[model samples]
Target chain A: MSAASLPAGEPRAIPTAFAIAEALRIAMASDPDVILMGEDVAGGGLRPEGTEEIGGIMSVTRGLVGQFPDRVLDTPISEMGILGAAVGAAVTGLRPVIELMFIDFLGTCLDPLLNQASKFRYMFGGKARVPLTVRTVTGAGLQAAAQHSQSLYWMTAGIPGLKTVIPSNAADAKGLLLAAIRCDDPVVFCEPKGILFVASDVPEGDYEVPIGRAKVVRRGSDVSLVGMGATVGMALAAAADLERDGVSAEVLDLRSLAPLDEDAILETLGRTGRLVVVDEATPRCSIASDVAALCVDRGFDLLNAPVRRVTAAMCPVPFTRVLEEAYMPSPARIVEAARALL
Target chain B: MTRPPTTEVLQVAYRTMRTIRSFEEALVALVTQGRLGGFLHTYVGQEAIAAAVCAHLGEHDHVASTHRGHGHCIAKGVDVRGMMAELFGRRTGTCGGRGGSMHIADLGKGMLGANGIVGAGIPLATGAALTAKLKRTGGVAVAFFGDGASNQGAFHESLNMAANWSLPAVYVCENNGWGEFTPTAFVVPVKDIAERARAYAMHALIADGMDFFDVYAQAGEAIARARGGAGPSLLECKTYRFLGHYVGDPLVYRAKHEADDWIRHRDPLRLFEARVTREGLLTESNLRAIDVDVAALVADAVARAQDAPFPDAGELLHGVFATSDAEGAR
Candidate 1:
């Protein structure tokens, strides 16, 4: 609630991808336990003619392989192997950050993540501490199509033992990611492919925004707009566009999906009395649905209307630009959903 | 790369195999008599691998296990009573019975877990080895997986990473010839799972899994090489399961003769005892004395297990997150 009344600025420039890479580098430098591993992370292990880059799949980890040669590993194209190794390393003493490259590739390595790391401490009766972070690119906009573009945070967030965090902006991305790496739990940090190049002001130094907390980006007293990852940007845009129509919309950035900031959602709903959840994932059993259910269960009396959800339709994300556009939640859709609630 | 283990090590090897065989036999009886709850994955046929491999390991060395893991846990120095109590689902059990047969673990002994997930322990073992290398603990980690788990992604990734980094790890694929109900031939391609090690640039060795001496000799060299920073090795112990996949599994998928034949002739403990007695290195009286002591140990463990209570209901929420509740939920 105190997030409001803070200073506002012109939102300086810091690429979300760079912020992530820089934050990881800082964490790795500070803690020797932190290590990076992924495919093509070292950019084919070749530095041809002034190209001293790791050539990360998304370039989010472009400079790390050069910084920490032994620590920054370029693994084979095996998601299960990469994730499993990260789990192993985390349990043994080192905190490993493995790149899934793309979230869709999770089909190959979900067991180590879902069954093993998530249940280790619980199954072992809390004797284990799996301090591992799996970073993967998610969402559309790259024309990489369905295989590369998916908002699958709902699956990881639903699992009890894992903590899922997705940051919407550069600052939050750096802060939340640092926190995730430091936290003594397995976390799936999904970076939206759509927002990689998008920029915001990041505090150039190491800082960790605690996991399991929410940040209210835009404040208004009418309807609350809840969104995460790339959709958070769209929701904020929709909120800005809605202000001209005299519709007061409070934009809530649902950063940490699992450890849902129930207090923030309840407090905002208690004041706004209306809700609109926007997600890039399919409608059936998504983060949107989870948030809506949470509101109904806890903030039922505070609602002025049935919670509105603007999410990707229940179908495979199409490859075509027009179809993909229709498949994902748009800024206009967020505005319309919130306007309807108002 | 080096000479085989001496006669003294061989005798220790025989003792380990005999202990594992008797412990599993005792557990099988307990399960049939309703003394144990849940399912049991007996390491009945794979005694040589655990005995031979664990003999070379010390307190600093680590080992990760599979679901069929009671033998490794015991061989690695986990209290027999704690393991038995865990199998009985008692509060005083190793994991408070929260983790049954598939999840027995003793962190103090550096036994990560007997993972239910196939091939999952491979990467965890590599990771432990990485920690050892970085911390300069002068130790290595071993992952004992079944032939069925050899084809898994964790196996490949861990092997590649360990070889590339030259981490001190030994991935011993206990080729007991079956994974659950399916035979290894039905799942794996090659007759020797160790041959796959070449793909990752790791050294591979094949050993007689039914003979404790062979297992101990080969595994000892592999472990020494790894601890000396020569990198990971794949030791495929060719063995056969003396019992069904789990307790009470009817050997309907395979011929019952295979299990019968292995128990009668290829049994690791029997083979170990015969070799020791024939060599005149250890007497039958010494083995008989060990048998009596092991029987008492197992019986005492069972008695303590029956007396141990179930975990408190309120403690269910504890241990999921490492931090204090006020810090953050895991």
Candidate 2:
């Protein structure tokens, strides 16, 4: 959904970060079973009442503790413990929405995600239901350096039993977050750090953007730009640039990665014979590659030219502004890739 | 002062210990005969720790276990037949053959899987305790890990979180002095693993893993503290592993007499029987009768496991994820 530049004062309009907090509040209010935990989720631990909550490094969970004092928790700076405990809590009857601060930190606590939470239902003869939602920040562009800015959604999506979703806008952010909390399986809800400040209209109260469904945010015919999370915005910007050049570029926001909307990918390729996949992550084994491969394998007949991919450099996210800009996929890069496909 | 266990509790404890012992011993035959295929970390000597600690846990209380997990599964009320089928990798196994020996679980009985990763289960139980405390379920969570797991970062992180939150959890370290092939002493810096709890400011206790009465008593207080909302506890049971690590593992890691001494003098099952029979809480005939019943039960489980078929090729795709999504937040 292409959210217009609505006035911030407008009703129902909220930033992606505020939308996340709103979704958490709605979830906790409706289901007492739903709780949130992470490092600094409820900041100022062990303090008297009225202390300001940091709501994690990005402040997506800010003001949550004051709202849901008992449910919103501040965990130790331990990713493994946070995730493992969340897994245990989820299977045992609590819907936990945990913040991982940054997706780059997943490597420190992947065992709980890879071995325990993801595999529990399947491994336990379908007896265990891990209703867990891991909300973490992703993508580069903030100059957060390689350590904090890597797009690791590819790793979680590649896993057998994980549901990975990345919303392109604040509305989907609220909807997807709610759906994740309700899902019986473990969901990695990736929030692209680049778009956290972007304002969009979000529906008040509860609504779920179904998992595993992609949204065609901007539709056209000549070419399709495939992207998820932050890359979708770049694709939209690229589509705008392509439109000026009279190249009708369709933007397919691939919100869900694991149970990938293969139908949408093939359908987009059918309408627009040329395709360009834009990704913030590196190209090797990335979602961009996956989509490109999917098109060749399943939509080979639909292709007019070879599928083109615009992705970050294979090297780490550079610390310098100019180098990092070159490292990440930009609208210009996406437009250039789409031109090649056309 | 804590009172001794009742005759009924002792009988229940004996039955659980006997079931675990018989189950592992029966697997020894199956593994030796080449009926079971996967790595089998037998809970041969660590029976008392699982049996006694799990005796205090009910259906609502959760227990996360280590690779040597059958005993924890049994003590926590997982079906022996399903567990046997799991070892056999049959469709009827606890995991529907998706998980082999290292990952059998029954959430209905609060038996979280036998984790393949050494320190993985610590946070799970700690999280379960978080659920118990927040939901006011009056339930406690137990993590039964090896001495080796005490050194894992997950262990330290989980304990620190559990103590900070005052979660209703009991950390049961089955200190069999071996983490995989290496001795626990060679790896862990601390002598009593319970000393690790001090860093978290948690209550700590230790017990001779071979003595069921000692384990049961110490575990009782820990579980009580957890259930009473007083907070978490670390109960380190000084135990031994009869089997090397897995079935068919050569006994070359340590001297043969080390296994022999623990088996002869500190055997949990033998100790239970001797103590009960000597105290007249139970007679030899009564113990023998229980053993016969256990043997029959084990024999039936093995027969059923072997008779069960392997999962269908199509079954490979099942249970990977929730087939569909739920509406709204729950």
Candidate 3:
């Protein structure tokens, strides 16, 4: 319910992926119990010269193995084993931050998250504690295609025991990842692949953006533009373009999905009677649909117009850059959706 | 012919086997009387494997169990009363009535719940061992799975990872001849499941699953190897399940004669009793006293379980997440 305080350290420009890597480095240095494991997380598995390989697919865990070689392990290409073992390690008192490579790979290893980590504390009657953090890449802008380019945070967010969070920028990526790693429950940390290379001013040193709290990045009184992950950037872009049309738009970034900041959503809707949800995921049963339903359920009286959602079409992400861009919910679509509501 | 176990260890093994037998028998009766709900898989004929393997473990050691996990739970020194209450769906159960027969878990005892999914516990145990290795806890993790699970991808992946990482883990496969309704031989081309461990470059051992001494000796070596940081090993115990897959199944897959043959000739309890008494490691009177004690213990557990009240409706929403207020909001 409380918002994470902004970091007090001097700000420096860094990529979101580098910010995540720094956060992991801080967590490992802070706590001996914190360990990192995933496929090629450390890289350089069989290199004869033993040079550092790709720190991670996106280099989010780069240079971590050099400092904490024992803690940061390179796992085989087995998502099930990696996740299941992470759950086991978490229950046994070690905090494990595992990489799922991509959110779509969740299909291969759903049992550990759905049946094991998510259900352990409940199924064991409050006797178990799974302090496991699953960090995975999501979003559809890279033309990585169907399997790799998917914003499937809603799946984990919908589960009962799991905590799902997506950071919209570099600062939030570092802070929220720290929070997720330190939190006592299982958290699905979704990093937007679209923003992996995007650079922004981020604070150095340790700080945590509390999970389940949304940040009102830009405030206005006419229409509310709500989004998360990469879509939040699109929402902001749309809000800026809407200013030319004499429309004052408020931008709200939902940092956490599972704890769905109902109060924030309602407060934003109360201030602005019009609402538009932008999500990179498919329309059906997605966060866009979820927020739209939330507005209709709790903030219906506050709305002056019907809530609208601008989401990607319900189809596999095409490989062509142009088609992929078209498939993704763009700022134009968000502007159109917001205009429709107004 | 490993050295005979001490008299005290033999008595402990006998009590474990006896407790498992009495517990499963009580469950069968409870299910037959329609008192217990959900699927019930009994570990009647494979008592020796759990008892002997668990005897080598301590409170610091971890074990992940299969669906037919009653024997594993008892062998690991889980509170029989709590397990029985869990089966009865009472608030006082191990999982506070959340986990039934298939999912009973007591983490305080280092038993990482009985999993419902096939081959799910392998990676869990491997991970526990990884934790131990990372933390330098010197604790070894054991996974008790069936012959059917060995064919699952999880089994291979877990074994390969454990071997690659040299994790402190031991995988024990109870080759009970059948995988649910189907014969394991029909599905698995291999004659011995342990032979598959060669792919991972790990040592594979076999034991008489029906003999307490054999299983104890083999499990001891494997568990010791894991604890000593010799990496992972697979121990396959040739055994049988006397009961059908679940309580309600008619068991039409196997001929009645085949079931009768395994039940009569290869019963683990019978083999243990005969061997211990003949070897003078344990007297017949000693085993009979254990049997009586176990029977009384099981009866008391059932009585207490039946009397325990069910969890209130409010409990339905609790315990999902450890720290989030969202669980309470839900």
Clashes of 3: 0
- Put the candidates in TM-score order, highest first: 3, 2, 1
Which residue pairs does candidate 1 place in steric collision? A43-A54
- Where is the poorest 10-residue window by lDDT in model 1 chain A? A1-10
**lDDT score, candidate 1:** 0.84
Ranking of all predicted structures according to lDDT, beginning with the best and ending with the worst: 3, 2, 1
lDDT of 3 by residue, B1-330 (tens): 244578888889989988998899988888888888888899999999999999889999999999999999999989999999999999999999999988998888999989999999999999899889988999999999999999888899899999998999999999999999999989998889999999999989999999888999999899889998899999999998898888878988889999899888888888888887787778899888888898999999999999999999966778777785445453
Every candidate's lDDT: 0.84, 0.88, 0.89
Q: Can you tell me which runs of candidate 1 are displaced by over 4 Å? A: A1-12, B1-15, B324-330
Top of the candidates by TM-score: 3
DockQ of every predicted complex: 0.61, 0.60, 0.78
User: What does the lDDT read for residue B152 in candidate 2?
Assistant: 90
Candidate 1 per-residue C-alpha lDDT over A1-113 given as tens digits, one digit per residue, 9 for 90 to 100:
11111233544466888788777878989998888878987666656787556457777777667678778777778777678777777887889888888889888889888
Task: Give the alpha carbon lDDT tens digit for every residue of A1-342 in model 3.
Answer: 001123446787778888888888889899999999998888775766845567778777777777897888888889988998898899898999999899999999999998889888888898788999999999888779999998998899888899999999999999999999998899999999878889899987899998889999999889999999998999999999999999999999999998788899989999999999998899898988989999999888998999998999899999998999889999999999888887
B84-172, model 2: which lDDT tens digit per residue?
Answer: 98888898888888788889888888888899999999999998999999999999999999888998999999999999889999999
CAPRI rating of model 3: medium
Q: Model 2's CAPRI class?
A: medium
Considering chain A alone, report the TM-score of candidate 3 relative to the true chain A.
0.96
